[model samples]
Target chain A: MKFSVMVNEGPYNHQASDSAYHFTKAVLQAGHEVFRVFFYHDGVNNGTRLTTPPQDDRNVVARWSELAVEHKVDLVVCVAAAQRRGIADADEAKRNGKNADNIAEGFRISGLGQLIEAGIVSDRLVEFGD
Target chain B: MPTVKKMMYVNRRAPHGTGYALEGLEVVLIGTAFEQEVCMAFIGDGVYQIMQGQDTRAAGMKNFSPTYKALGDYDVTRLYVEQESLSERGLSVDDLMPLTYEDEDDDWAEKPSVQVIVRKELSQIMAAQDVLFNF
Candidate 1:
């Protein structure tokens, strides 16, 4: 079964993103395809490359980046929400005339339409939020 | 096939204190463009979102009660209120704003949108959904 995961809250402050990450991992491990993982609302904060957790703590942002690299999972962050929260990739930063870009590796910034598309195409769309 | 997926929106938060209820409604509104089979269930504190005569003026928040009335115009019907959630909050159908939709198939007759359901039945609705939006 193809599964689409949605995380609606920021990491650490809320366990939403973390729970989504684990669920996505388990889905992949169970031989199920993860259609996409769309980050919306405060969940876009998990895509910032600048976040540096302590040495022992889990790096939520880096874990997602690694998931993208290892599993080739599609990690999408909502562009409108990301813009308001200051998360932009290189292309978006250049287009919007912003000085700095903080989008972590493996995550792409897109519109809410991508989220809708994921729901349309995937068999199951699971959401994690407060 | 009609390509109409079973979609369920499970709301479990209050109207204010956060953007969940408002944004959740916006998602449902946008989702109507797909013409999917969508249903919304109010559980836990989420039932408060339908409380009638909600006055958010004191908190400087936008009163969004009017939008629920407009949902039927957009064909975003099937609003379900959990009986347990309402009873736990000491509320009943009288405390809620009645929502209705026009059935064009049935000569455009008006029909009530909000369906008061028990928690178990609401769970069955949730399990049957292809896409579950929890906000």
Candidate 2:
């Protein structure tokens, strides 16, 4: 089965991101295709490379990046939501006249149309949020 | 042609208090561009989103309640408001904004977009959807 995941909350503060990551990993391990993982609202924080958790704790952002690199999952952060929350990619940061970008590897900034497209193409669109 | 999926955006939060209602509306607006059969459901505190007389000037927020009016132009006509939810919140249909749309197939006759249904009915409607986006 093909699946699309939506993370609607930021990492650490809520378990939504962790649950979404584990669900995506389990889906891949089960041999199902992940159409995309669309991040919205505070969830866009997951795409920022600036995240620095305690060394002993699991790095949520890095885990998502590694998942994308290893499984080739499409991780998309909604541009509008990201801009509102200060999570910007290199191109977005340049366009918005920001000095730096913080978007992590294996993620792309995009419009909400990507989320709609995921709902259209994926067999299941799963959301994790408060 | 892309398949037309029945996509429903479920709102369970009140507006202004959290960013969910506003961001959820953004998704609905963007989804309409995909030309899918889209609908919105307002249950629990979400019913307050479409309530009339929402003023955010004092709160310093961009009162986006009026954006719900523009959904019809995007061919998004279904706004399901749960009857029980309203009663639970001490509100009625009269408290909601009179959202309407012109039916292109029916000689542009203006029709009501908000449908107040029982929870049971809303459940069936949810079950019929190809995708359900909860906010």
Candidate number with greatest lDDT: 2
User: Which residue pairs collide, candidate 2?
Assistant: none
User: Candidate 1 on B1-135: residue-level lDDT in tens?
Assistant: 237788888888999888778877877887787888888899999998888999989999989978999999988789999999899889999899999999999999999999999989988888877777888
Alpha-carbon shift of residue A33 in model 2 (angstroms): 0.4
Mark the regions of model 1 whose C-alpha exceeds 4 Å error after superposition.
Answer: A90-99
> Residue A124 in model 2: shift from native, Å?
0.6
* Residues A1-130, model 2: lDDT tens digits: 9999999999999999999999999999999999999999999999999899999999999999999999999999999999999998889989999999999999999999999999999999999998
Off by over 4 Å in 2: none
| DockQ for each model | 0.53, 0.95
Query: How many steric overlaps are in each model, in order?
Result: 0, 0
Cα lDDT of all candidates, in order? 0.89, 0.95
